[model samples]
Structures are given as C-alpha cells and as structure tokens.
Target: MEGDLERNNHILGDRWESMMSGHMTRIANEKGLDAQNFRCADCTSPIGIFYGAPRLCWYTGEYYCQNCHLMEENMIPARIIHNWDFRKHKVSKRTMVYLTQQWRDPCIQMDEVNPSGYRYIDELKKLLPLRLQLATLEPYLQTCRMLTPELLSTRLKGLHHMLGNPHIYSPHDLCLVRDGLLYNAINKLVQFGTKHVRQCALCTAKGFVCEICGKDEIIFAFDDMTSQCQQCKGVFHKRCFADRCPRCERRHNRNTPL
Candidate 1:
C-alpha cells in the first residue's frame, strides 16, 4: 500500500508538471504571435498607435502605417477596415479572407462621384455663385475626389470656424465625440485646386478651353475628345471627360429625378 501510494503521488507530480509546461509554452507562443500580428507587413516595423489606437489594416488582418493606408489625398480605400474597439468581430485569417473577397473593389470607381459623400456640393454651390467663371472649378472638383466621413467632418468644422455664424453647437461644448483622423484631406484639396485650376471651359459662351490641361486648342469636332454634361451643361476635354468631372457627375448622379 505504501509503495502504491508513492507511485500515485509520483504520477500526479509528473502530470502536473506536463500540464504546467504545456500552459507555459502556449503563453509564450501567444506573446510571440501578438508581436508578429502588429508588425507592418510592408515595412516590417511594428505598427504604432495613432491617436491611442493601433494602426492596422482591417480587411487583411495585417498591420500598415497610416501613410501606406492613405496612399494619397482623396484616394482613401472605400472598404478600409479600421480596428476600432466598436468592431463587431475581431480580425482573423478566416475573417480577412472573407472580407477581401466580399469587398474586392468598390462598386463605384474612385474617380466616379460617390453620392453618399456629396453633402458639400450644395454648400460649394452656395459659396461659388458664379460657377461658369472659374474654368478649372470642375476639374478641381474632379481631382478632389475622396471625401471620407472623417474628411467631411473636418471640412464642416473648418467651414463652421471660418464662417462663425453660430449655425451649430461646438463639439467641445456639447461633449460630442468625433473621430481623431488628421485633417490633411482639406489641405490636399486646396493644394490640388490651386495647382490645377487655371481656366474654365464654360466661362466663355463661345469656344471652350480644356479645363484639365488649360489648353484652348482642343478639337471639339470629335465628340469623343470633348463632351458636355447633360445636367451642368459643362464641356470637358476628351481625355478629361474620360478622367471624369467628379463634382458635376456627383451632382447629376445624386439629384437626377430618381
């Protein structure tokens, strides 16, 4: 009986050690994976926290720097998945595959005017009463394509501050929460407009100049090289038309008697 008891105790001791060892190994592995997961796939650098949140690509289940994600101004990915705390599901390999396939590309192209992000069109129209005079306005609008929700908020805030007419309550005063994205988009639009808009196609009632290149020698006889918007009645260079006039296109697509 003594021998049996000693044998049982030895067996229990061995089992406990094995279990503890397994648990420790699992913990080590988990820590390693946690580090790996947050490392940027492109740069191999650990993704740093931006505004207290870790920067990561939501769809790919991988890390990416903010600059990589943005790529350029007004070119934000439509289905960019943010790793917000409010996310319904945690990103994993299986979820990433599913998301990638589901949101392969946006239904509306990037150059195409997204109706959802067109709240500023009316405001812009109000600001610029003499639309036909600014020959490059349409092209500038086209180049200033993206208006992410974050960007839209920034724009509204800027406009509110500039106008200062007490139209809306202050975000700070009201304790309203807002996304903490950098407002480079507003400046980006301003820069592009400043550089690109030199002439207007519709300013002169007679001959139209190419708003995109600022060249007056556009061959209007070729219907393909030059086209007029049905809604805004704005003429565009063929190459420019192919590129699209985002503002007029957006306005047309949104307010068309649908």
Candidate 2:
C-alpha cells in the first residue's frame, strides 16, 4: 500500500506538470500564433503556408493534422483534475484513445489533486462517508470464508474496488458519481456488507465485546458507538471508555519485569 501510494504520488506530479504546461500553451495561443513553420504535433507533417494551419487539439493544446486529429471528442483529464469539468472537447485520435484506455484506471486522488473541488461536488461529499464505512467493513467481510465472489458479484457489479480499497478512484467512477449512480451503488454495497457481517457466524465471531461495559452484545470496530484502544486494540463503548483503556494498563503491568 505504501509503494502504491508513492507510485501514485509520482504519477500525480508528472500529470500536474503536464496540465500546467498545457494551460500555459492554451493561454499563449489565445492571441493567435506568429508566422512560422507549422507541423502536426504527433506526426510532424508539414501544415505550413502551402497546406494551411494545423488543427488545435483542445486536450494537449497542440496542433495536429487531419490524419492525426480526426476531430474526435473526449473528456480532458487536465480539465477534470483542475476544474472538475466533465464536458468533452475536440482532441486528436491518439489523445482520445489514450484517455479512453486510462478512463478505468484508479489513479486520481481528488484530495491531493483538487482539495477545494470537493465542496462544489455534493455527490462526492455524500459518497465519501459510504466509502469510509465500506473501508472499515472490508476486513470483516474478507474474513468470512463462506462469503463467495458470486454472492457479491450482483451487489458490487462494476465496483469491486470498493471492497478492496476506498481511497483511489477512476475517471469512470467520477463520471458515475457526477451522474448520481455511484453513490447508490456504493450505499447498497455498504448495506449488503453490513448485513452479511452481522448475520454470518464466521464474521460474528470476529466482533469485539465492549470490555468496559461487560456487555453481551458483540460490537465491531466500525460501529459509531464503539471505541478502540490504540495500544491493545481492545474495543469498548464510547461512553464507557472515556479517554484511557484499562486493558492496556493491565497488559502493561503483566509484561513489566517485577
């Protein structure tokens, strides 16, 4: 997980630099290009005074010939990252193909890419809590040997990643979020997982009893009313375990040399 995060951070850095360069190119081109030797950005085909000016690709802010830029339209990652814009713009065929292939890759980290953008996207805000709950339930669900992939296939459908990891999101996922479909899908997944853990005998055994309250009810670490000890990892009712964990102290006394 640490390695994955480090790789993602590196990718984000590269993407940020590319987006900034593209933005600057667009700004510079706003006033029109000066008379010079023109060529396609991809194929390097001459599109000069004799062959007319090259077509502009809205994605990379570069010029390309008709063969290279077939007027294909696609969502720009730069626009999505910087402004959360989903509108498609005219792009080169190569750019379109690349974007399409990368659409389903879980690379985008919205918090790092655009922190303030979350405030503008209400659906994303709603999805955040559901993802957090799902993240918490992942370990319990995975421990249930009886729980098969076939059982979850219908509920998860296209979003198997929700069960595995919650932080990373694909561009396709964001599109679904924008359409107000992903939230419902994830909400149902959380409900399904919660139900499974509560009912399954294998999952139920994993639940922690509130040591402080000495209650018969089995509670999970994910429960809002439960608190976990940082040292001993003992779970207890929030009200019962006010600040400190007694179990940690007891364990410490036992381990200490007399």
Candidate 3:
C-alpha cells in the first residue's frame, strides 16, 4: 500500500495528477528494490507490499525472503511461531513456520538454512540485507583471497584474536574467526606455495606461537617476547626455561643444576 502522501494525492483532486507523477517516479527509483530483485517469495517476481489475503508480515524492519512479507494477503500464513523457541513460536500447536497454514504447504525450516559454519552460511548470508552483503563481503573476501601464507601467520592470526577482544559489536558474528585462522594457516602454505607461514611464538617451536606471549620463542628465547621468566630476564622455552631469577624458588647461591 502507498503511504499517506500518495493516498492524500488521490484525495486532493486538484493536484492529483502531478502528485501521482512524483509518486511513480519515486517508486521507480526505490533504493535497493527494483521490480526484479529478491522476489516475492511466492510469485517469483517483485511487487511492493501485500495486496493478497493477509500475506507475510514484514516485522523487524527488513523485507525477509523467508518471511514473504510482501506477497498478496491470501498467500500469507496466518500465524508463524518458532518451534525451537516457545517465545518465537506460539502461533499454534502444530508450531512450525510453514509457508502456508492450511497444512499442505512445505515448511520453510532452518535445517534447510544450512548447519555449517559461517563460511558456508550463504542462506544466512542471503538473508542479510541485500544492499549491504555484497558490499561488505566483497572487500573482505578479496583481502582473504590475497592472503599469502607468509603474511597469514601474523596478519590472519592477529585478525582472529582481535575479533574476540570483546570490543566488537557482535562477537558471534565471527565464531568462524578462530577456525578461519586455522583454515588460512593450514591452507596458507598451499595457497601461496610456501612452507610454514608463522612460527611458534613461544619457544621457537615449529607451529604457531603461544597465546600468552607475543614472542616467537617456541624454544625459550627470553626477553619480552616470551612468557615471563622466573630465570633472569632471559626467556626460554617453557620446558627449557629454568627459574634462576632472584625470585626463583629453586635458586641456590652455589652454581646449581639450573
């Protein structure tokens, strides 16, 4: 249905033609919506809002393809409740978000939405407001595509850690982050035709570094990079690091086995 401005034009009688002209122009140029996009979930084409028998409800602000909120009124199922959660699903006892309520239509279930991680979550990705998903994912995926294994050890690993820093808006938006790091770190050498990208940061080990210290001391290279030492300032691999510092519980004045 058209808004007050458009409806008022139909009533004004005097300026109706000009008002109609402006309205048509505005409709033709709507931002992310054209007659061809996102489709009406039922008719497989686009038209705005419901004119059918109690069609889908566009709650929560965005036009959802799954919700089918813009179809004709007759096409809309009367009630939709989420069976998984009682709060979202009390529409009826059958309690399934089916495409229609007459018990004949196929249910639009979430299992069909793909249970894999975000990397494979295209249905969820598709549900993202169409205007922004490509714009957002494109640059991000491009950066992901350009990653050489060598740069991944530091760049990709840190990116994963930073996403979980508890400062971002939605930390869950990136549950795939740690996994992404591992994926990139593993496929990195293959993608760029290299050996190891990042080195173990703890005691100079062969794998990635420890989360404790930002050092590459997989073998216990002391200093500030490795874990704090009980020995002098000298850091060593966790196993090799001997407690010889002044605070050492095992330090003997004589030359001890340390």
- For each candidate in turn, the TM-score is 0.21, 0.76, 0.20
- What are the per-residue Cα lDDT tens digits for candidate 2 across 1-258? 999999998997788557644442132232222332477767778875577657777766677788998888977665766566888888888777777777787767767666666687687777787887898788876667888767767766878776665656777888888888888888888888888888989898988888777889998766778787877768888889878788988888899989
Q: What is the Cα-based lDDT of residue 33 in candidate 1?
A: 21
Per-residue CA lDDT of model 3 for 4-121, tens digit only, reads 8887866765463443323211211223434335454333444455533322332211223434443323211211211111122112111123323323422223232223322354
Residue 61 in candidate 2, Cα distance off native in Å? 2.6
Q: What does candidate 1's lDDT look like per residue over 75-117, in tens digits?
A: 1122211111122323433324433443322222211323332
Q: Rank all candidate structures by their lDDT, best first, as comma-separated numbers.
A: 2, 1, 3
After superposition of all CA atoms, the RMSD between model 1 and the true structure is 21.0
Pairs of residues clashing in candidate 2: none
Per TM-score, the best of the predicted structures is 2
By summed lDDT, the worst window of 10 consecutive residues in model 1 runs over: 75-84
lDDT of all predictions: 0.38, 0.74, 0.31
